[model samples]
Target: MNNFFPAVLRLIAKLVILAIAVIAVAVIVFWTPGKPADELAERWATPPSLFMDLHGMQVHIRDEGPRNDPEPVILLHGTSASLHTWEGWAEHLAQHRRVIRMDLPGFGLTGPHPREDYHITAYSEFVIALADSLQIDKFVLAGNSLGGRIAWTTAAVAPERVTRLILVDPSGGYPLPPKSMPLAFHVAQLPVLGQLMDYMLPRFMVRNSLENVYANPDLVTDELVDLYYDMARREGNRQALRQRFQQDDNGHEQAIIRSLEQPTLILWGAQDRLIPVANGYEYARDVRNSELVVFPDLGHIPQEEDPDQSLQPVLNFLGLAEQR
Candidate 1:
């Protein structure tokens, strides 16, 4: 019996050593340090990309199209996504209407908010402040995922600023958990794992998250992964991501959805597993003036997956379809 106890202790010690070795190897393999926004700007922030002082951060933004348009179209990308996500849509939309898209406080080159307040209310307020800074009286607000929630919230809080609403797989209408959350997002919500992520991030993690949101994993190219990976590595973004997940109330203020008076267009990926297409129906049912469109083959980020197909409805909604 004494020998048996000694053997067990020896085994336990060996296992502890093995665990430490494994962690050391992982740290060596995935030891990605945060990069200053200036370091990444040379490559990611080219022409048309400018940083403007707003809301206590140098906001990364792209403003395109005719300046005379009274009510421009403002596009907001989802969590973990930068303004690049809307590039395909922006390229085309800017041809006709003024399209403004930015890297929200927690993501992209904007880094983390000084106050570290990632509540949906803070995001909505930031949008309003951005509009005011641009001297825009009214705008057609369009957003996807978390950005969708912010868009609707902005409309609810500052109805006078939002002339129309376009929600693409927005994160609201019932607080139900995602069918399949991305590995990175899941990690960001965990205490230990999220803290570790602030220091070491693997390229594959970013790629896996992209593949999770994309219906066709093949569409997740190395270039796409590089962009997302680089953006995530922006100094303070990792910590901000963790804060965002913690602050997320999962659409607690969604009751205001029913009270939205602006014309609404709802878009969803029929194949979306993250938020599910059913939420699209919920938005349509609650918002009195809303239309829902679902794409059979796309996933959570239909706009990025298939911009051409996803943008047709938006064009029609904006009365620019005939022009195309």
Candidate 2:
């Protein structure tokens, strides 16, 4: 018994040391701040044409279209996505109505806000502040996936400001959870290993993510990979994305969707393994005077996947095109 006591004591000491090391590692990782968003923003550095201002933090947004256009549309992208998601749609829509798209804090070149929560309500406030800054009274709002969730919430809370609502595979409001959520979601859900992702993101990680969302892998060009990979390296962007994934707003937001009053158009990829097609129907039922359009071969992003087929339905809903 006396001999066994010495062995047990050695094991206890080893475990105590190991525990301290683990905690120390966690504290350092969590508290350590990251670099600025410049590296991430480099590939996206085009001819200077963005407006940056501190609305809590510096926001990067593109406001286009003729000043005289009455009905404007604000576009929002999904998780780990940037304002460029609407590049194709923006080129077309800006000609007709005022089109505004942005890199939401944490995801794109805009980076994360100083605020810790990054809640839906926090984002709702930022959008309103932007409208006030632009001196606009009311306009149409559209978003894909996570952005779509915010669009619905913004309309519900501030219906007076939102003229029309458009959603593409938006999360949070719909009952059906994402079918094959990104690998980041599972990692971000973990306690320890997930924290490592925010700090050290490989270029391949970005490539894998792009391929996963895209319906056709061949469509993901080297340039596209470079853009996404570089943008993710921006100082605060990765951490913001990490935290955004960790924050769960699922249960609290169904009531927000129920409160929506504005006319809405729900567009989805029928082959979307990310957020299932059931969400399109769920949103269509919730909003007043809503319509749902599902593309057979499209995945998560119908706008990017098949714009020619997708845009016609959207234009039809907005009454921008003459009825057939």
Candidate 3:
């Protein structure tokens, strides 16, 4: 019996070593770096794409429509989403309003911020600087998820500059965890496991995240997943995301929301799984003069899921119905 136990132990050790070897080989075969901004710009960067030096970083922005529009509209996307997420909205709003969207630092072609600061304060400052550089004295600010949080904070900081505020499933107001989170976000928040993603990321992972955020999984296309996958590989982006998740402390959300006095429009997807639809009610309750519109069929990104339907309320709220 003792000899049999020794032999079994030896066999288990061999199996463990073999498994390790296989995993190492897989990692080596799939190892990859994020696509360069220049390379991604070739395919993703379309007409009207402009790059500007802001805070010593190259920012990718699209300034569309009539420049003379009284109050220009600035749109900000959610985490892991690029300025491209606003493409549908930009197409419609640009007719009568100058719509501007940019890839935030640590995302898309903009790459990562040198300072590695992804806090709300830093993001709000970035928005102000971008507006100042563009000489936009006053503008309408709208954002989704993280961008939404930044938008309200910006309005609180410079109330006079932001004529109107729009929040689309914006984060903050409530700290309750979602029913389920995107696997990629959960992995990125891990310690050692997150670092492995920097070396190798499968395209399927991107697809899964897109699927998770969209109300309809069919909306997740191969090309859309490619854009997300490639941009994630952008040098320094993965690390920047890790830092942002690790360092972000959303304790001051209540104070920020309570202090907001701007005319706010809160849009949310009733099917939103990331930041539950309940938070939408919380936002409307806190913001004194705010309107909340919930899309029964949409998920986290209603604007992208169904822009035509989602943007109608925004137009009405912004008093741009005449232009429509």
Candidate 4:
């Protein structure tokens, strides 16, 4: 019996060592750091894509549709997302109204902010600067997730400039942290594990994060994953995200929502595990002129998940829809 126990223990130790060795090899094979912004821009930034020097950073922006249309709509993408996220919406909306979208600092091809500022207020200011640079006096603002938070804040600070607001699962006023977050995001929140992400990122991790946020798991295709993965590896992008995660949460949620007087549309995914649909109701109640639309089968990013279905209500709200 004593000999049997010793033999089993030795076998277990060998198996453990072999497992560790396999993992080490896998890490070495997949330790891809990603391409620089210049290289990615070659493929990602095609025609109609323009880079403007704003706040000392080269901002990637796309202005589409009718330039003469007043109150041009400015679309803001969420954390880790690029202007391409609005491609579907911009395509349709641009037909009637001028549509503008940009890759925010620390995300997409914009990489990181020179000042290393990722706060909501900083984003708000960046929006204003972008608007000023474009000579836009008044415009309609729409955003999803982190972009939504910036939209509302900009309205509060410069109500005269933001004629209306569209918030799609905004983040500033989350009653609580998301029920579930992407594993990469969870890792980024950690003190030590986050450092490892700065140096190494696995394509599977990006794929996993995309799948988690989407209502349909199958939407996380290879091309989609490649877009996110390449952008994340863009120099300084990962580090900027880490800084953003570490920043203090902006408080006074109710007050911020209450202060909004612009006609508002609150869009949410009922199945959103990130920011629950309940938040859409709270936003509707607080904003006197606001209307909430919840997608029963959608997740956090209904806009991207099903743009055709999600954008119809927005078109109606903006009075841009063709009358039947």
RMSD each, Å: 1.2, 4.1, 2.0, 3.6
* Over 4 Å off, model 1: 3-6
Model 1 over residues 57-128: C-alpha lDDT tens digits?
999999999999999999999999999999999999999999999999999999999999999999999999
Q: Candidate 3 local accuracy as lDDT?
A: 0.90
- What would the per-residue lDDT of candidate 3 be over residues 30-103, giving only the tens digit for each residue? 78777778888988788889899999899999999898987899999889889999988899889878999999
lDDT of each: 0.93, 0.76, 0.90, 0.89
Expressed as tens digits, the lDDT of each residue in 83-183 for candidate 2 is: 88888888777777788888887767788788766788878887888888887889888999888888888888898999888888788765666667666
Model 1 quality (TM-score): 0.97
- Residue pairs in candidate 2 whose N, alpha carbon or C atoms collide under 3 angstroms: 35-235, 36-235, 37-235, 40-230, 40-231, 106-111, 145-170
Candidate 4 achieves a global lDDT of 0.89
Which 10 residues in a row give candidate 4 its minimum summed lDDT?
26-35
- For TM-score, candidate 2 versus 4, the one ahead is 4
Which is the winner by TM-score between candidate 1 and candidate 4? 1
Q: Which candidate is the best by lDDT?
A: 1
Range of the 10 consecutive residues with the lowest summed lDDT in candidate 1? 246-255
TM-scores of all models?
Answer: 0.97, 0.85, 0.94, 0.91
- For candidate 1, give the lDDT of residue 289: 95
Q: Who is ahead in TM-score, 2 or 3?
A: 3
TM-score of 4: 0.91
Single out the weakest 10-residue window by summed lDDT for candidate 2: 40-49
